[model samples]
Structure formats: structure tokens, C-alpha cells
Target chain A: MSPQSSVLYDAPGPRTRRRTTIAAVLIGVALLAGAYYLVYRPLEAKGQFTAVKWGPLVDLADPNLPLVWERIRLGIIATLTAAALAIVCSLLAGTLLAVVRMLLKEQAKRRYAGLPAAAAYALRGLNTALRGITRFCVEVFRGLPVLVTIFFAWRISGISDPLWPLVIGLSIYNSVVIAEIIRSGMEGLPRGQREAADSLGLTPFQAILLVQLPQAFRIMLPALISQLVVILKDTTLGYIITYEDILAVAQQMIQILQNPIQMYVIIGAVFIAINYALSQLAAYVQRRVSRVRAHKPAAAATELAASEPVVLDA
Target chain B: MDVLIDNADVFVSGFWLTLQLCVLSATGALLIGTIVAAMRISPVPSLRWAGATYVTLVRNLPLTIVFFLTSFGLPELGSNADFLRVPGLSSVFDRLGIDLPYFRFAVIALSVYTAAFVCEAIRSGVNAVPAGQAEAARSLGLTFRQNLLSIVLPQAWRAAIVPLGSVIIAMIKNSALAGAFGVTGELFSSGQNLTSSGGNPIIPVFIGISIGYLIMTVPLGIFIDRVENRRAVAR
Candidate 1:
């Protein structure tokens, strides 16, 4: 079999493929050597850096090693905590609002079914306001960059803590996104599903919690995971305000070390690895969730998909 | 406040330069990004791999690095230190028939970074189009370019609006980073100028920087949103 067919074929028949592979390997090796020369050698020549002391990554004894560890530790703590809080809070708030809107829609549909015309107009206005407010909040948050928002929080808010600023900024911005996701998910639900729940005498709250939310979360998991990745990246923005996140720490080291290229290359590799792992986790969860309801209808699947954030924040 | 008002011309001129930079870089980036995107989704694996790697490296790395690379490293590469200090590298390159140095580097970096994002946006947009659309166009005897330009692209562009909008906004924000190295008339320029002149609070300087971005982007954001809402209604 040709190399492309088996997905693991050893037959390297194409001259171009073989050349390209070799070239890529060489370039990678060259990049690694260049990095070693730029970063590792500079400190090594100074005698300020000891390889043995830096060997234990978690140890705080060595100045260089501690600084690196602290930066990574701070970055992880800030990002993971903020993302967890934002996801949980946003999911709850979004789901609640979605349910409320859904209930309102159903009530409006029922009341307008045989209503007096003037009364129906007032009801429509109210519904419009709810939708408008939801959209407006989402837009305001989405429109502003997360860095600016975080900066504002740090500048004006009572909380002077770096981590709080990141959490608050990311949470508020992501909450807006999460709400839109949930609203869309709710919209994707079939009228019949709600109608069936209603006909069976289930309260609106019960119908949403029992019949809708579980399925919506399943669809939303991948999008949520993607959002988590964005949240992870935004944590680096803390560096701008002297917030001591990983990127900030790296930038500081670059200034002190005077080796921009090597520092950035290292940080980029780390970021890519972290994000790749997160995405893989997301995919795995998505598959596991989907397997639980392999036979679900298109409407349910659509609703589930809607509940997840579609746009990956860069 | 009065001092700032008195030097309003400086601010205005700065604003103008910043606005120009934002628009110029955005346009340049979009064009570069589109080409990169095409290369990325090309049938040839080498082009596709190159495009993918470019986007991955650019997107994963911070914009500050790119800014520093052009601002600091490029000067060292060229023999003409005197030429590098000139407002535009065009003079150094003008000897070689090139012009527009300050704008060129800013635009190049902005385009390179933004192109990475644009590539992703375009790739996603292209992917969103069902395979059948291109297949149908192909089956009908339209050339590949003709099919892309006439049919595939128009549809992809529309679908790509959300991500594209975000990318453009990001470019506007990134244009400020250019001030860190060169381009004194940009948003970051005002901060650099202010710091050098009287040493106002950096927070306020950054705030001003952000406000400048808001003025450039918020309107564009509203427009994209209206388009999205219209699409939603149509659906």
C-alpha cells in the first residue's frame, strides 16, 4: 500500500515526500540547536546558571528555576481557577436565563393564541425587551477585548489582586458568550418537545431541567472546552499589567536575560502543548458524551450543539 | 487635562496616524491572510503544510515577539544602521527602489500575524461550504479559480464574517504593539510620547490606548453584528 492509504505505510515511494520529511527533520534539529545556543548557552557561559540546580523544576532554591516555576504556577492557578469559575457560573446563569426565555415564549404563544389584539402587543414588547437586553449584554462584553476589560477591572475595582482581575474580566466576557450559546440551544429545541412536556403537566422549570438542560450540556461540552482554551490564553494578558502570569514572567526574564527569540520560542511550544492537550481532552469528552445518546434526534442534537460556544476566541 | 487639550493637535495627529495604521495594516493583513488561506487549503500538501505551520506558529506566539523581532532584530540584519533609524526603511530599500519603511514593517508584521488568523477563518469558511458546492462547480466545467471566485468564495466570505470580524478587531488591538518599537504616531505612540514628555500614569496611558482601539473597532463590531443578526433572522 502507498504511504497515504494505510495511514502508517512505510513505503516512501514519492521522492518529494522523502525529501520533505528529511528537510523537516533537519529544520527541526537546526531550530533546537539554535534555541540551545541562544538561551542555554548565554546563561551557561555566565556561570550564573547551574544545570544541576535547575534540574528540579519545582524547587525554589535556584533563582532562575524558582522564577520559572512561580510564573507557571501563577499562570496555571489563575487560568484554571478562573476558567472553572467562569464555566460553572456562566453555565448556570445562561441555562437559567435560557429557561426563563423559553418559558416566556411558550406563555406568549399560549396567551396570544386566543388573546385580545391590544393585550398581545404589550406582551410582544415585553418579549422583545428580554431578547434585546440579552443581546445587548452579550454585545457589550463581546465587543470589548478581554485585556481592556481586565485592565479596567484592575484600574477601577476595589480588588487589587491580579488573579481577581483576570477571573472577573474573563468571567464577565465569557458569561455573555455562554448566554448566547444557551439561548441558541434553547431556540434549537423542537416545539413538540416542550409541548409534550407541557401536555404531560410538567412545570416549565422541570421541563427545562429534566428534559432540556442535560441534553444541551452534552452538545455544549466541546464549545465549552474551546472557551476554556481561550480563557487559558487570556491569562497571559495579565503580564501586560505586571500580573506575574506565565507570559509576563517569560517577558520579564527576556528583559533580564536579553534573549527574546529563545524565550518566545520556548513559551510558544509550551502554549501549543497545553492547548493541544486541552483540545484532545475536549474531543475525548465530546465523544464520550455523544456515545451516551447515540440515537438522539436531530433537534436534540442541534439544541445540544447550540448550547456550546461555536466561535473559538483567539 | 488642559495641557492635553492644548496639545490636542499632537493627539489628533497621533490619532490620525493610528487610524491610518489600523486601516492599512488591516487591509494588508486581510489580503495576505486570504492568499495564505488559499495556500493552506490548496490540493498540494506542501503549500497546505506551510500555511498550517505559519498560522500555528504565529497564532501560538504573542504579537509582542513579532513586534520586537522586526523592531530590534531586522536592524541588526541590515548593514545600514543609519538607514534603519530613518522613519521608513524605504530610504535604505529606496536605494533598491523600495519605499515606506515604518509603515512597511508595521504592515508586514501585522499582516503576517493577522494572516495566520485570517487563514484559519478562511479555512473554516471554506470547510463550512459543503463539498458538493465545489464538486458541482467542478462538474459544470468551471475552472478552479472561476469556481472559487464566483461561487465558493462569496459563500465562504459570508459564513466567515464572525471570525473575520474578531480577527480584524484583534489586528486593531495589535497595531498598538507596533508603537513599542517604531511608528511613533500610532496609539502606542501617544503612550510613548506621553511617558517621555511628562511621565503620566501608565495605566491612564494604556486606557487611552484602549479607547483609541474602541473608537476604531466598536463601529465595525456593530456592523458585523447587524449582519449576523440579519443572517439569524433569515435562517
Candidate 2:
């Protein structure tokens, strides 16, 4: 670090400087030695650091390599398809959940407003029941690991598509998370938005659907994209169930090719690339949203009718 | 339900193992994460670059890849099993009653992957510590380490409570993946075993397993909320 210290603190005194220099050198040496021990030396001992292990990967010129690429292409397709299905399903499920949770609270409020003798009692019962069910679904799905959720879906899933289990599992767990994101986004809006809707003669439900939700969903787009990346990553879990996705394909090929390290590296890099592209797409969309909102603030509500994805805080 | 009762031992142990994995991994993650967070906020440029690179690389990668590296990849190269036998570590493992090689790999994978998230949380927490606090510490003639350890980290952790809680809950859910890699006596594997064993009625087994997880995860979440609320009120 430069001795040109910024506002956080002044440059270290002579003793402090010597101590920091010694500490930095020690940490640097430790880092280098740790890397060598953990990565370089062990792999070298196993002959994994040699060209023999990596040469096949470098020979992209071979004509027969297209067959291997074909399997990888298919695996990538399967992984993406599963992620797409899960993302769609989760968004639908999450919006429904957020709305349901909201209505449950709203129903409780109305229950005490003296609607009627029989109807109030029925509504009370219904509200209590709905509240229990919603809370259970949200908490259980949220609390359960995604893999276990997938395991359950795999066991029960009777669909023809082999990926149904993964899709269902991802949707259930992520929707709970997504619902929280969307609800929090709405909750974050200024109370003035709702008061304006009320003054404009919109009912609470209409205000939620038209005014609050649209705004929240817009603000939530970036977070939603990040969650989609998570879903994409979890698609690798499909390997456990013997799903022939990209990761599974790599695992299978690694056995035949005897290049586990190289295969997994390639697979990991593929995932990183795809996810990085998705993140960039999210950033681009965020910029576009801001641009549109800035250009014509009045038309944003109408023009943004489509449910752009909602973002989570994470 | 009958399946659940018949395999109560499996479910109970699975819950225990999952809980053990979460606790150990969360502790390891917190330690590693704090160091990385310190590196991130340090005055050293190289340290900051190293920290940033780690967060970027690991955060973008799938946890499954991490699990693969530790479980399958490491074993392929050589054995780190001897490290587990170190007196201090082994006795801790003995107390936890988890001896499987897979459990060790799971702990390594889960903690390493989780540390990236935890580092981000803590770095943000560090950033949230008002600049004035550091200035005040400097004015008090405290050393840089003193400023960080005494003045900064305590408040950083407070700022980090919610995100760190989410990371812990996420870690709990994530520990279930250890089962896929042949970590016996964990929730996911136990559920998987029920199916392969035949005539076990798999749906209820998994529902039971999810409930086992909820037993661990929900309480942690509620506890974090209580802590956050308490911290807020104190401030």
C-alpha cells in the first residue's frame, strides 16, 4: 500500500510502518506457500499438472472432438431449459403467494369490521385456514434445502419429462424466496403511492395490482435476475438424480476420458460464463429501466404492463 | 408416517448430522470470512485485489463445483485425510461424532463457498461503519489494527447481522447437498436411501426430512430476527 494515506488515517509512524511491512511480507509468503501446497505441488505429484492430463483438452483441432461437443451442447440445453421453466414457475408462484399473504392480512382486518353474523364467522375461519396454509408452505419450502425439495419432487413427479422434478423443486423453494423479495419491495414503497391511489378512488386490491405491484416488480428486476442465476447454478444438482444435464454429461465423460479435473474445470467455466452473461443482461435491463423511467415518467405505468422480474435484496 | 416411524433412526441421525454440518461450517465460514473481510478493507492494494478476486471467482461459481472440488477433486490428487487426524481437530470431530471422509469434504466445501458470501456481508458491514468511527479511533491514538479490531468489527458485525443470518440459513439448507456426495447420515441421503430401499413410500419420507430441516432452519431464522430487533432497540 502507498504511504499516501487517505482521510481514514495518516501514514503509519516508523514503528507502525515496520510492523505493517513485516506483517504484509509474512502474509504474502504464507499466501504463496499455501497456494503451492494446496494446488501446485499435490497436482504435480499426481501428474495432473503435466501436459498428458491437459493435452487432449488443447487439441481442439481433432475432427472427432465434435462428438464430445455435441454431448456438451445437449447438456447445456437441458440445464438452460430446466432453469427457464423454474424461473417462470417461481415468478408465478411467488406473485400468487405475495398476493395471498396480503389478502390474508386484509381479510383479518375486515373480519373485525362487522360484515355479518354468519359471513363474518365464515370469513374468520377461512382467513385462519388460509393463513395457516400460506405460512406452512412459505416456511417449509423456505426452510427445506433445494436439493431435498428436488428429492421430494423427483419421488412424486409422474410427468413424462425427466426434468419435471427439478423444475417443481426449484419453483417451490425459490418462489418462497421470491415472494419475500416482492413483498419487501412493495413494503419499501413510500406510503404516498398508496394514499394517492386511495385519493384517486382505487380500491386496495386495485391499488396493489395496478400501482404498488408494478412499481415493486420494476425495482425488483435486478434481484430477480440474480436469483435466476442461482436457479441456473442449482441445475447442476440434477446430476445427483442422474439427469443428463451439462454437469452430468461432464461427469459421465470424465469417467471415459479419465480427465475429471479438466472436465469439471470446463463445466465450471461454462457455468461462470453463462451466469456472467446473465448478470450483464441484468445490468443492461436495469439501465434501460432507468432510462425509460427518466424519459417519460408518465408512461412508465402503462408501458411496463408486462411483469418485469422482481429483485431480491441479496 | 409409517415409513417415518420405521426409519426414525435414519431421520433422527440425518437431522443431527445436518445440524452438526451447519454449525461447524458456519463457524469456519465466519472465521475465514472475517479474515477476507479484513483483507478487503485493508490499506494494502494487493490484499484488496486478492480479496476481490476471491469473492468474484467463488461467488460466481456454483456450490456444487466447490463440493466437487473438495470431495472428488481433492481425493483424486491426494489424501488430506491425515490433516483430519490432527489431535485438536480429531477430538472436535469425535465430540461431534462425525467421522466420515465425506463429512470433512462437506465441511470444507460448505465453509469455503459460504465464506465468500459471508465476506461480502462483512465487507458491506465494514463499509457501513461510519468513517467518523475510524477517525475517532485514530484521534484516540489507537493503532490501525486496534481501530479495526476494537472500533470497527464490533459495529460491522451488528450491521452484518441480517445478511449473515441469511447466509447461515442458506448454509443450513446447503448442508443437505452433502448427501449427494455419499455423506451418509445426512437428511438428503437418508431420503435418497428410503427410495432406493423399495416399498418405503418415498413422499412421506422426504416430507419428514423437510420437517427435520425446518426444525433446524426456522429457529435460527427466528433467533436472528430477535437478535436484529434487540440490536435495533439498543441503538
Candidate 3:
């Protein structure tokens, strides 16, 4: 038994140990039988295990192997290209939107004692209108499915190239999501950071831009990387729009080789490998960030006490 | 406006299908996710390994690839060749007067994909329960299963509700992919059909489809916020 199991149960006695051993063996046998009956037999029956199906992907000696790898390489490039563009766009736009919303809220609260009453009222009205419109856009884009947004971008923009629409659509949806992440990250910071910025005579916009935003980005690095993984995964949706990303390229190969199962399995494994690596990076960053905070115990304690709980936005 | 009015039936039925997809997939995900969570927390090393492997593999793979695998791979395996011929399973579906191979495939894909996230959410919830709770239960001579069912899970579920709501909401959006991958009459494909063949203007058709999704998602988003706020207050 694992150490973690001790939380729920004590070390087993002889009889309990034997019982657990028997249970484990039973589960092992069941798992093996299930795998054989549900997976191997059916796949074998369809001759999916045959060398012809696997050769292009796995057999170094196969004549088609080089071409297959080349296509896969190109496909990966296309996928990364789209994902990178979308990630950059989303991050910049999302931060801008977050900052704008924050500033608008600040403006709404300010008494504007130095300004005339009519001018102050006009400024407040503008702030409210901008806030309302911004909120509506964020909510709409966030609520709509990324695919639907891509379709709308594709149709409305009359973009013939699938990559632009895919990028635009991903940007629109992910920007709002990232905005929420940034907002939460900012909220998670100690209130004193904002106060310090204010004491230094920085305006609300400058304080956010110089102090809060950078710290939020640092604190939220792990989450941002995870979101990158999400964007990378979503780039596959370009297949629906006929974008020649890796998945679409795999489909074309399947059409040629008549090996849908093998092709898809390969594609799925590729995705898993890339995304797993990205997630591991996110985890590493999270560990490093926390460790840095741990070194500053006094500051960390105060930060923790003052910070609001940061719930991940979906 | 005219396009939306003229095609009201399409939008309604499309969203109805989307709702069905979400409901079925959510139920399947919860069931499988709970089992996987149990496996992960079990004392047996092999079960823990199996559960970890399942979650890792599924979580890393894209939902689109999962959909493609089910749409193409299941037929090759002969599992979904004819849903009506699957013996005991067929009878249940037959009695319900429904047999949709593509829809079933899509549900399988969504459930399998979403179950990974659900497992993580549930495990986090379990982790949120203080160690003292479990230790106390063990000291009281409650067995692992009894302790989990009575003490751990009851509290874990309360913490899990917010994350689960988010997962379900994401599932509703992810279900849009099913419409593209041969599950017709869902919001996406209906919009596609209207714009391409029904001679409706593209903007209105998409706007109508957007509303269909928002109607499902927005309220759920609000409810989750409310629940989260209440939990914060309680804490």
C-alpha cells in the first residue's frame, strides 16, 4: 500500500493483508481480461495490427516512412504557428481588457473633486458606457464556443484562409478567459502592493501597468502556460474549417493509406506527448513560484492573509 | 430578425439536441470519474497506477482527437457498427426507441475526455478534506470504505460542486464539436445547415446559434458564481 493510503486506513493485519493481496490479484486479472476482450480482440479482428497499417509510421524500412514524417513535421509547424499567433494575441488583448475594466471601475468610484460638476458627470457617464460595452463583449465571447466563434469570424470576415479565422476566433475566446485569469491573479495579490503604488504617486493605470500587472503575470505564469496548452489543443479544431493542421494532414494521409485508426492513434499520441510536456512545465513553474514565495516567509504570510482566494476561471 | 423568426424551430431543436448531449455526457463523466477517483485512492498499487495512467492519458489528449478516434476507431473495432445489435445494451436503447451510432460515439468521446477533468476535480475535493478528518475516522475504527463514504466523500462533494459546475459548463461548449463530427441537428451543424442550404443569412443564423449556446451556458455561469460566493461566506 502507498503511504497516502495510511490517511484513510491503518497498517493491515495478516488477514487484512491477505485479503488485499487477493483483491489486487482479482483486479489485475479483471483488467487484463477486459483489455483483451475489449481492445486486442476487436482490433486484431479488423487486421488493424497488421504491418501494412503501421509501417508508414513505425517501420524505418518502409518507403512511405520518410514522406509520412515529413508531412507530420510540416503539420506540426502549421499547428504551432497558429497556436503561437493566437497565444500572443490572446495574452496582449486579454491584459488590455483586464486593465481597461479595472481602470473603468476606478474611474466610476472617483469623486473627481477638482473637476466641474458637469464635466465630472460626463466623465462618469462615459466610463459607465465603456464598462457596460466591455463587459458585454467579454461575456459574449467567453460564453460562445470557440468553434462557433471561429465559424463566425470565418463567415463575417470573409477570410478564405482558414488559419486567420482560426487564429482570430481563438484569440477572441481565449482573450476573455485570460482576462478573467488576470483579474483573479490581481485579486490574489496583497492589497498593499496597490497601496504602495498609490503612495508613490502612480495613477491607477500606471500602478496596474507597472506593478500589479507584472506581478500578476509572474504569479499566474503556471496558469498562462496551462492556457497555452489549451490553445495548442484547440488548434486542432482547425480541421473542421479545412485548415491543414496536423489532424487535417493526418486525415489526408488516412485517405491515402486507408488507415484511419493508425493515423488517429498516432495523432492522439503526438498530442498527448506535447501537452503532457507543457503541463509538466506548468507544474514546474508553479513549484518554483511557490518556493520563491516560501523563502520570504514574512511577506508570504502577510500576502496569504491579505490575498483573496483565487478560483480558477474554468 | 426575419431569419431567426423563420428558423426558430431549427434553433430550438438544435439546442435541445445540444442539451441532450450535455446531459448524457455529464452523467457518464460523473459515473466514470467517480470510479476513477475511487481507483486512484484505493490501497492497491495497481489500481492507483491504472487510475493515474487513465487520467494522464485522457487529460493530455485533445477532445477533438478523442472525437475523431471514437468516430473512426469504434467502427473499426466493430463496437459501434450497429448499436441495435449489441445484445443487452441494444435492448435498453431499443426500449427507449433511440439508436444513434454517431451520437453514441460522440457521447463516449466526450465522457472519456471529460472524465479526466472530473477525476481531478474530485481528487482535489478529496484533498481539501483535512487529514485530521480521515485520521479521526480511522481512530474510530471505521474501515476505509466506510470512512470514505460517511465522512470524506460527503464533505468532498460539497467542495467539488463548484468545480463540477465549471466542468459541466465546459462540456456544454465542448459538445459543439460533436455537431461538426457527424452528430447532426445540434446547434453548430444546424447553423451550418441553415447558412449553407436553407438560404438564411450567415450572420443571423450564427447569432441565433450563439443565443442557443448562451442560453445554456450563461445561467449556469451565474449559478456557479452564486454558489461560490455562498461557499466563501460560509467559510
Global lDDT of each model?
A: 0.64, 0.77, 0.84
The DockQ-based order of candidates, best leading, equals 3, 2, 1
Please write out the lDDT profile of model 1 over residues A79-111, one tens digit for every residue: 566566656766676666667766666565555
The all-Cα superposition gives candidate 3 an RMSD in Å to the true structure of 2.8
lDDT of 1: 0.64
Residue B105 of model 3 has an lDDT of: 82
RMSD of 1: 7.1
- Candidates 2 and 3, the one with greater DockQ: 3
Q: Itemize residue pairs with steric clashes in candidate 3.
A: none
Of the true interface contacts, what fraction does each candidate have?
0.08, 0.46, 0.70
For candidate 1, the iRMS in Å is 7.2
**Rank order by TM-score, top first?**
3, 2, 1
**Model 2 per-residue lDDT tens digits across residues A96-186:** 8887787677668774565768888887998999899998888788888898888778778755456988889889999999897788667
Per-residue lDDT tens digits for candidate 1, residues B118-140, read: 87787677666666777777678
